[model samples]
Target: MESYASSSARPDRAEPCPRSAVSHGVGLAGLAGLALWTVLAWRYGMDGPHAGIFASVVACGVPMLLWSLLVDRVHRRPSTGIDWSGPRRSAREGFDISVVKLAGLWATWGAIALFYGTARWYWDGGYSYAMQLFGWAVVPLLLASIPYVIWLDRYLIEPRDGAYAFGQWVIGGAAGKPPEGAIGDHLRAWGVKAFFLAFMLSITPANFANVIGWRTGDPLAGPVELANFLITILFMIDVSFATIGYMLTCKPLDAHIRSANPHMAGWIAALICYPPFVLMGNGGPLDYHRGTAEWDMWFAGNAAMLWIWGGLLVLLTAVYAWATVAFGLRFSNLTHRGIITHGPYRWTRHPAYLSKNLFWWLSVMPFLSTTGNWVDVVRNCTLLGITSAIYYWRARTEEQHLSEDPDYRAYHAWMERRGVVTRALAALTRWSGRGSPAAHPERG
Candidate 1:
């Protein structure tokens, strides 16, 4: 099945409005305030003994509320006309400069704050029951800000030229209208969403249960516990973002899914890695720590070394989450809202997959198991290897599907030539070849 690009002609495009700057500024200020609050809370340790709730409100809730109000007011004004000539601007020129700068700034600061806050929470002996309850209660409220922010971008902050930044990543510059797919494509979209929904539901209880376990003073010791806690939190964040991105915001305006992967092999490989289907596989869910007897054996006994490993795991997890953050309201497995070329994508074509696979290898320790038998090690390694291969296939299939679009093709070419991974590999090959017989043909 071939995926087509959107039409070049869009009569509905809107003109640039000076009022958009006001909305953009207000939205940006709110993001800045939230980021600052998070940083301050982490740095100063939330003031008093009972200050967590207040801190959360100040850090996340208040600014978002203000931003929402300002955005609503901005949208109440008369609508602007479409700017047909706006498409002539370069990709960089097309984006609202204020939005782009603010989104990047806020995303960077927010990620740093979240990482520091989460690490501090775990390292300082976890949270009390009241504190945990307060924290969890505040999560949904904080997440509520996402749709509002997206709404502001859609209706107020973004230019009528269809140019806007989604949390540090800019999309839309001479990009055509999204293609209307066949009934089969629509069914595929529904099917993909259904699978993600099921996946999210299946993992929800386990993540929350972990939180409860931490609150109840479960026997979580050293880095393993820390790693597990961080993973759970990151997973929860992903689930929330992915669920909202897939279910709520997927529409013709900003969230329109351009295409779904029609390859059966891609679906089978990707789907089998999650949920009840994962149970069908012997290795179980591509997560090395789960469904294995040797989970604890991977951690070092030394606290310092364990902490280092735990920190590394958290970093990897953060990178994985950063990819999702870059996607913003467009994240999903089978659909392509747009091609992201910033954030973690700036470094690797598949940052999430690469980091996730590395994380599994580190945390799962496939080389070591309970039994001394090499067979067990081999089996475990094979399972993980297959899972990794599946992701590789998924990436390739996605690339094939996306390559049909000119924007994606341009992005792919740029990444191939200038991306970090590509450059690093080229350097490595050059270094290795320098010492080889092939480099010294006369001596040979």
Candidate 2:
């Protein structure tokens, strides 16, 4: 709802700007400058808010400088043996950019513009209402989101490899050495798909849901419910963080990991995790359009199922966290890391995959309220099921990769021996307790 129109008084033209220019200009400005831009915008009386436009341009530039400084510092003391002089390297010798990199940069800005523009036009009624509604409620929520958005932008944008492909900082030396060409290739494929799908998917359900919820006349569901809804709306945060966490911990320990396989697994993982939310976002509105009363009933059922299944996913989170912490403490490097037999591994060979299935399973249940509506129901169920299958197959592929590694073979033998000894001892103890205490030399 914030006026995106740059005032004619501003010197800059409105033609599609490059990503670097926009990101640097906007980022340097920060939120405070953006606020000033708004005030200046008002002062110009909506005719030509040059002040606002200039302020915005100035603020965005700051981040570019900051980003450059960080990259220079990091690469200045490089240990990876990667030449800062690599052909793709920037003048600062900090980060490298590729055609895909440029594409990512431009695509992000374009997407943001498209989003705000579409929201301004299509969801006009709800946008105005929500602004007023939030005047009392959303202001504080928006204020809180300031830090969160800053964090998201910093991680998602500023760093080389940024959030899309890889993180810039190695952090406790915990990051795995991504397979050769993996970072660039991964970013190219993942970035394109994520950009397009997220833009198309985020607006429709989000606006529709907000509009419908506001229309419900339920005072109790005001800002609090809306806040909760907003968090879920950004479910990508959870999915993305979860993926990053998995990589930090699980990837290195995955003795089966091969350079090629991880990329494929990454794709499979994204397929399983991201697409459902998109389907859900767009589909939620369609279901609601059937009728408000029916929608509410269905929404409750769907929300319940989602919540229930989400609760189950807590188990996966724990596993990912444990692996991350363990790897961080024990071994500095993550790659060719030996397979772990403790924690969740002790229970099942593939706890992560099991967790992956649980994640999707929860996603499917929430829509059961609309089970009668075959399109929405079938569409989600089928994708959910298919993606889960893909994740399972990816897991098998990773296991195969491990099978060839010598370190992995050693760990496998150790685990097998440990398991046999422990199980036999337990059986002997049970037998002795029932009758006589017998020492079994064979078991020893």
Candidate 3:
């Protein structure tokens, strides 16, 4: 084993990069080049046959050819400046503006291209009917995105630029200084928050459009449309509650919750749930046919399941509302309250996370029993699982930050002692074992 000192002395050389690094670098370079050329061709109005040939060459071959010759230039630099472990807050004033400006442009053109391509095919033959409907459902999202982009650019970005002067002019005390916490350095958090808020808001219009299109038989199917509709509604409710909680606990949105990083959790949750909407809207793997528009046996059963499960999600949202309001009432100071193992926390350290999973799971009930639809169910469930995993990690990181607090340690210990989850698991295991014995009898 290498000594710590030896390892420290030549960190880069201690464990040299894998032999396949060159191949991996080449692959990435090729991909980026392909993407760039594809964008260029689309911009230049490429047509069929010749356009297809030229696009393939530019998008696939050109990047590879260039990368093969100038690998050093292609793979010269690694990304830097992101301090994942750094302080959570900063004083930067207008950082959000630049981010919104750039991401807005990218999202705008990308959305246009996506919609145009999908629409052309959809109108051509309905061969990809499911995909076209999904795309149409996303139209409202595009509509809402415009205001959101402007909002971020105005409220977030502009302020960060001349915020220092503005702050000094507005306040007699600490006028010129950046607002507390590590000034300027943590503005990236604000940028992240602005991006997510805009993104989430953008979805609402699309969801509305989807419901309308489905009702009118314009493409988006009934089952797929219903699934996305409920999920989007739940998400909107969640954000509304969170915002209320924030306002109730913190000051005006402008005052507290200004730093981006700490507020990023909500945005992260949005990102976690976004893609599943598209996947579920695409009608799963097997082209599910509910037969006719009339209510059938399967339809009735699934509809009942949807109501029951969706009701449970409504209950969960209520739980979120209560918990969020309670959090504000308890920790209005914006500081972490140790382990926070109270109320819903007592049942599970993160009830909000579990509730989020519940909502998505409920949304998948319509397709749960169908064979191919299982793919949609699994895809949605996986998204929830991954999101929960991310929250678990964030919870640990938070615990580390607040570990010095005696109350937190006590709460942690109490939660551990409860062992509610372990008991539940044990019961499940016993039940499973008993069922197997009954089914198989004594094999010997």
List, in order, the clash count of every candidate structure: 4, 14, 14
- Cα deviation of 396, candidate 2, in Å: 1.3
Worst 10 residues of 3 by lDDT: 1-10
* Stretches > 4 Å off in candidate 2: 1-336, 374-376, 410-444
The window of 10 residues in a row where model 2 has the poorest summed lDDT is: 1-10
lDDT score for candidate 3 against the true structure: 0.38
RMSD of 1: 15.6
**TM match of model 2 to true structure:** 0.32
Question: How do the residues 74-153 of candidate 1 rate in per-residue lDDT, one tens digit apiece?
Answer: 22333222222324444444344435434433454355336435643322322233334435545674566444434443
TM-score of each: 0.56, 0.32, 0.37
lDDT of 2 by residue, 1-444 (tens): 000011122213443121110112212223344344434434444322222223323432233224324532322322222233432333333223222233343445445445545545323542433233223543564455334333323222223343223332222133434346645544443343333223323332332233223322443364335433443323322222222222221111121112223345544443333333322234442122221122233346476643443444444545443332222211111123344444434434454556546654543353463436667556555655665565555455555555565545544443333343334544676777863323211000
Q: Could you tell me which 10 consecutive residues in candidate 1 have the lowest summed lDDT?
A: 1-10
Candidate 3: stretches off by over 4 Å? 1-181, 184-237, 245-310, 329-342, 366-407, 422-444
Q: What is the lDDT of residue 284 in candidate 2?
A: 44
